[model samples]
Target: MSSVRRIAREEWRLWLRSKVVVAAALIVAVLIAVTSILTANRIANEQAQRVEQQVAAEQTFFAQPDRHPHRMVHYGHYAFRPPPPLAVFEPGVDAVTGQSIFLEGHRQNTAMFADTKAAADLGGFAALTPASLYQLFLPLLLIVLGHALFLRERESGTLAVILAQGLPGTKLALGKAAALLAVIAMFMLPLIAVAAYSVTLGERMLAAFSLVGGYFVYLCAWGAIVLAASVLLTQRAVSLGVLIFVWLFAALIVPRFAINASSAAVDAPGKIESDLIMLAEQRKLGDGHNAADPAFMQLQAEVLEQYDVETIEELPINWRGVVAAYSEAELTDLLNSYAEERMRLEASQSRIFGLFGLLSPTIAVSSASRAIAGTDLATHHRFLRESEALRFGFVQALNEKHAAELDYAIDMNRNADEAARLRARVNASAWQVLDEFRFAPDGADERLGRAGGSLGILLAWLLAAGGIVLVAARRVRL
Candidate 1:
């Protein structure tokens, strides 16, 4: 223990004396601090703006004057997903998947207002977020700092003298690795502070801890790989080159390959293709606007038999409203079926991507970070589901008002006479009976559960790297 401490202390002193090392460390630390502050503020401002927009949308909806219930359905509503607090660290798919969706009858609109799809008036270098900084550059810095940790001593004969004096190779390796880990801790100070800030956001303690822990393990894994390469490769230049190549392959190449592979493996339909297919299937269901269509004729017969009435006029309810209600229910069922299939396809693609984590710790840590931050595809899917539920329920409620409130005679003649149209309108107070849409993100426990697979992958990487490091350290010689 004492020998290890002495070696680590000496290594630190040397690092402090090197101008390049000091400058590099200072620049990264400052960037971390600046990015953290700016990202946090931007997320907070966007969240506040979305909240205000949501409130205004609800107010405008309920403030409408009396009108036909079907008209209200076409008027639609907007659901703005509130960004989770941890999004300050890992905004994940938030920028690309969009922040809001439009809800109306018979159509499940795609989410909109995505930052990526917005006007590109700004520079294209906006990918430099806090998560990117940690995932991509930090490991490269580690490689540059420690690629020659023990190789330099071995080449200069200091390692031979130390071994002659009875310093076991394992102990020397442990000491040097400790020094490297100490440097990692210094680099992680800004991340730790970010975690602490996240913990104050109420009920995010577990997520915050998971975020910091995942990154720590990821960096530690890199440290082991670095030392293993440095001690085993003999030549410093060879070790440096190999480590840089490994970093590039793991961080950049594997992720892209995995994405392309998953796309090929899954073959999910594009938006336009999906829309066209849905429209074709909908045509088979018969036109809802034509009450004389065979589908509606069968429905009318069923209603007449149920009520034991001879004519539409003798029915106790407005026949038009009943047709509207039936059409909506059938349409909603069709929409839900397609929506579920799309979500299932996306989940499969994500699972395929996750399998590649075994080849790259970068993918593992990134998956875990997004899951912990509630910014993954699963969370976005949850938002879509909640919004759809709101849309379906509100639209159904309006259909109910349409059937029970308006007179059949007035509705049938509404298009011809202004007086009949006025009589067919349901009171605007009907919208008040519907509930507002609010997205519920997963709780800490749920998020941690979702991240479990990726975390396990990271653990496996660390353990495997650690074992290689130990064996390679043992083989280190004069």
Candidate 2:
């Protein structure tokens, strides 16, 4: 045991003395730091720009002159999905998904703008924020540095000499693993610091903690796998090559294949198909503009009767407002239902990829990281749901105001001069009274519960890999 410890210590000293290894480690560390800073800055700037545009658009829409309440319904409103606070760490699927959606009466608009997939092939490689760097690239570095730890010693005839001195294989493997674990810890320090800072900055502490915990287990799994490979391979070159191949398969090939396969499995309909389907469903409900349509006229009569008026024009409530409210409700229902179905498809796609975690710890780590950062597919779906709700609420509030405050006789009759006047006026104060959209952050307990499953998977992988290391130690030959 003492001999094994000495050999491990010597290996660590030798690694430190090697200028090439030291330089490579430094270079990777610098790249991680720079990438994190740059990504954070870029996302912050983009968010600022988006907020400005959203505010400007909202102001312009509200500045419009009063028109038929139905006309205002058609004008609709835009809802912008804001970037999550910790998005800089991962960004995840945000770029792939649309960021802004237009909500109008009687029509459901597919979200528009922001498609990361349109970028060139190499774009993914360079999009190495903290999560990608640690979850994808750092494991490869660990393999490179640690894969030949035992194999090289054996190849060079050092392992037999150390073992002849009564050192057990288990001790030798554990000592080497300890050394490699130190290297992994150093490699992860900067990222862990960033996560801690994020927590201090009011990001969910539990999410950040989960992010760090998942990463630790992921790196440890890499170390264990490398140790096992080292013990199994008789030659240093063979061990290194095998470890590299494993890293490539686990980190790159398998993940890409899973994504493609999951996407195909679900057969997610295109935006156009979604929109057209919603439209068809909506037509079944009475269109507000079809005045002579018996169903719509009947609804109008029912609304008038409910308000205790013989005619729409005689109602204290504005008939145009009432019609707009009903129309908005029907349209909102259609959009919400369609949106939920589409989101379910996306969630299914994610689950398919998640099942591949057994083959690739990279997949597990990436998924866990994004989940904790609130930048995964699940988080994106939540944003869409909330945005849709806010849009409906905003539009409905305006419709209700039209119903309660406007003069029904003038609005319903559309007397030429009166109609013209109504179309040209609305109080600015009324527009100002509309609430601005604000997204609430998820609570700590929610983030923990959400990431718990992914974290458990990663820990299980780590334990299985560790078991492999134990098996390798027992069977290993100098």
Candidate 3:
């Protein structure tokens, strides 16, 4: 322990004497602080903006004057998925998946306002966020700092002097690693502070915990990898080159390959294909607008039979409204079928991507980060599902109200009689009876459960890397 402490102090003193290391460390600290502040503020602003927009959307939806209920269905409401607090650290697929979806009757509209789809005038690309620094830059800095930790001693023939002085290679390796750990801690201090602040948010507290815990292991693994390479390699240049190449391959290149492979192996329908398929299925089911269509005629007959009425006039409820309700229910079923298929495909892709976690620790860390932050594909899917449920319920309620409130005489004669048309217009107060769309985000327990596998993957990498480092340190030679 004394030797390890002495060597750690020795390594620290050397770094202090070097102006290059001091400047780089200072610059990295400043960058982390700046990025953390800016990203957190930006995410908070966007989240608040989405909440305001959602309220406005709801207000506009129900604020209509007396009109036909079907008009309200077509008017539609917008559902906005608010960003989670942990999004300040890792926004994940939020930038690409869009934030707002138009939930209307008959159509499952695509989400809009994706950052990637922005035109040049609309802010062409996403600015560098804090997550970018954590994923790409910090590891590179660690690599550059520790690439020659022990290799430099070997290069300078200090390894002979140190060994002759009776210092074990393992103790020397442990001390150099302690120095790297201190440097990594400096980089993480700002991020940890931001995460601590996030813990004040309800569900994100646990997410912030996972983010902090996962990254701790993740960055330490990198330090171990760097230390192992330095101690094992005889040449300083070779150690630096090999470590940099490994970093690039694991962090940058392998992830791209993993995504490509996952996409290819899992045959998922694209947005265009999914949309076209949904439309075709809806068309086959029936057109809700055409009352005289054969499909509608059958639906009318079924409702008449169900009500024990010989004719539309004898039915207690408006037959047109009944048909409208039935049509919506049928269409929603089709939409759900397609949605489930799409979600299943996505799950397959995620499963395949998990395979790459064994090959690259970055894959596991990225997955764990997004899952805990509630910004992963799973959360987006949950948003879509909740929005859909609300849309179907609201649309169905309107359709049912259209049937119950309007007299059959008014519907039958509305085309020719102005008085009947006036009678068919339901009161605007009807919209108030409907419930608002409220999406309750998953709780901490759910998020922790979802992120567990990815966390395990990171832990596995840490353990494997630690084991290899011990072995490498024991065998380290001049």
**Clash counts for the predictions, in order:** 0, 0, 0
What does candidate 1's lDDT look like per residue over 8-83, in tens digits? 8888898899999888878887887888888776776777778888888899999999999989988999899978
Name the candidate, 1 or 3, with the larger lDDT value. Answer: 1
Segments in model 2 whose C-alpha atoms lie over 4 Å from true places:
1-8, 48-76, 114-126, 412-419, 422-424
Question: Which candidate gets the maximum TM-score versus the true structure?
Answer: 1
Q: RMSD to the native, candidate 1?
A: 1.9
Order of candidate numbers by lDDT, starting with the best: 1, 3, 2
Clashes of 1: 0
Residue-by-residue lDDT tens digits, candidate 2, 11-125: 7798889887787788888888998887777667656666776787688777867555445656777777766667767777776777788866666566676444335624665
Better of 2 and 3 by lDDT: 3
Model 3 regions lying over 4 Å from their true place: 114-127, 417-420
- The lDDT per prediction is 0.84, 0.75, 0.81
With a 3 Å backbone cut-off (N, CA, C), the pairs that clash in candidate 1 are: none
Query: In angstroms, how far off is 309's CA in candidate 1?
Result: 1.2
lDDT per residue as tens, model 3, 28-90: 778878878877877777777788888888888778888788888888888888888888888
Error of 2 at 319 (Å): 2.2
